[model samples]
Target: MSGFSSFWASQNKVFRISIILLLLASITYGQGNRKPFAIEGKLNLTSWDIDQNPIELNGDWFFYWNQILTPQDGLLSFNQENKNIKSFPGLWTDYEGDTSYPSFGFASYLLIIEGLEKDKEYALKVPDMYCSYQLWVGSKLVASNGKIGRDAESYEPEWRPVTVNFVAERETESILLNISNFDHSKGGIKNSIVLGPVEHLASQKTNEVAANLIRIIGIALISIISLAGFFLYSKKLFTYFSIFSILWSVRGIFSNMYLIYSWIPDFNWTLGTKIEYLTIYTSVLVGYHIFHNLFPNHSNKIISWASIFINSTFIIITLVSPAVMFTELLNIYFGLMGLLLAYILINVIQAYIYDEKGAGYLAVAITLIIILFFYDMLSYYKFLPYNPYITSIGYVILYGLLGYTLRYNQLHKSKDTTFKFS
Candidate 1:
């Protein structure tokens, strides 16, 4: 077979594979649209009508403290030597007989009631408190919040209740509650926490005012900076693109925070919101412009090909996949960015190898930008504790580099003018 024919066959196969993958992703997304079960937030203890049977899980029994665990044979028993009874269902402050907050707090409850049923599903409803809380039914640790459940890690305080099914004893049962305050370092103060029964809300008034304030402040600051840039740079195409990028970024963050839809009641807010797409698109445009600026001559085919492939793949994957796929897609984007950065860095190094002037500083600046990008991605993925704002550090360095390049060009022009006069 001819070499051209072989190349054509290879290209055809690659094209077919790409088409198949796209189709598969689309199909998978479409098929996985089943509605998930809705779990209600925090339970209300008061006015809880027993639909099936009455299984009271609330009763005060005993208290104690122990760092190490030992076998015990009591319906209600814990280390009481650390006698310091704080408050319940909330931040425990103003404990009697204890000057400072106890290192740990544990309490058990025992209740005697005439109406009790067997083989009924019951749950211990604890108010959202400072740290972690554990519950025990008949000496068995039944339910735990912020420690045993997935909802524990999230700080969003919803009225979601934790349910645990228990086997009915021949007689009445004992319920124990153990709560631990993980840290008091940040001046742990008193807060509201209450155990309550479950009830449909009379109103679903989400607390969006605070979120709106944050969004407004963030967006306003970004807008001011963009406007200043327009004034400073004469509204050039690059400046405008950068402004749009930042506007989109602000919008994306705000929308993700649900500030836009929440504050603007008239606006139709959908469950599956893709408002962040605008931000992603604007970012790509800015990146494209940056690439053009970095490689003005467009002399390297490999760099151009690789960048196009990576960016095109990112755009397609992001558009087709749902938000849940963001974790996986973000990894792809991060990898692409890393490779593109390394490619640029290699070119910078090559420039220096050729004894090129001003290449050293450029190399350092590029390295810094790459490092910042990696750190920002890590932080975004929750792998690092660094601030998300770290990504903008690269933008600062980029602006400084552009200014230095412009000033150097002007100086070089002056040298040429002097030579001509001479």
Candidate 2:
């Protein structure tokens, strides 16, 4: 076999390598020579060119708060000399240094990038905002995610990355963002913003959206496989895991929700936010069942059932209530999460103390989860500088642990059965 394999490898290796290299070169050359679909701007936009090849638009900008102004406001009787926010990656949260920060109200940012070609095509690439915003390019409203409201029940969170395409109608233009936040723990922009040729940003976003879809679909597959686990092994934990993963994955659909919005143009984003929290609330309920089944001896069945009942009630209420009401319930849900986590930790500790089989591994995983959850929560609260992808990492750890536990239990049960039969 080795002699034949050696001959086969030697026979076509050079030819295969040559073909691959030729194809790669051809592809590279073709892409290099292709003309950009949108009009090209000079390299390096000194402002909000935050990060992009052939440049991004990021830098210092003028900012003001306490009002949700329109492009017309900036045009008619509006002062361009409003106090500078004095940041490259501008966010109203930066102003939180002052105790009087208007975190829950409206703020406007203004920047003008020049050296663009007249009548050429361009698009501003906007990342997720804390709550809502309206993007304006020289008095033209180009894009907005959710309706921006100035106060409590009026504010909503709808964050889907957008590429607002337009003709570079003039060489110099006003890039105005009327941003408001009342949903996130920390309100306002926290990342670099960009503006450039439509094709440059659009192509980059196409790749990003493709990745997001793949992630959602992968989780979707996991949910189906988990559901099938019940029939294969006849364990109730599989059912709980199925629901939990499905709920979490369904919530993730909002991240790439533009796909749905594209098909249903009139679809309101507030509905998406409601459904997001709905899934979140329900997922926590099912998560309790997972623990209840996994550690039936050490878990408190009454508390688990009560959690499910309460969460279910709220979810029903969310379905009927206005989206604003749903937003109001978030703090309560988080408080419940704290209580649930505390209760589960107590149960896990008891399981570990009693020397329950496999409890050690679960304890370790849960401990890591608690740490990461707190870190991520702190980051969310503006108490930390790190914006690491802790949630997804924590989920991966959880799913991996749950999968291993199921497999271990199955294997142990099968061995015991074989021994008894023998």
On TM-score, the candidate that comes out on top is: 2
Output the lDDT of residue 304, model 1: 59
Error of 2 at 256 (Å): 6.7
Candidate 2 residue-wise lDDT at 161: 73
At residue 162, candidate 2 shows an lDDT of 78
lDDT accuracy of residue 64 in candidate 1: 38
Taking the tens digit of each residue's C-alpha lDDT, what string does model 1 give over 2-60? Answer: 99778767786778797786687566555433212111211222233444222222222
User: What lDDT score goes with residue 43 in model 2?
Assistant: 26
Return the TM-score for candidate 1, rounded to 2 decimals. Answer: 0.36
Local error of candidate 1 at residue 152 (angstroms): 24
For 238-285, candidate 2 gives per-residue lDDT tens digits of 676778777777776665435555545456666776777788887887
Clashing pairs in 2: 47-57, 47-58, 48-57, 48-58, 49-56, 49-57, 49-58
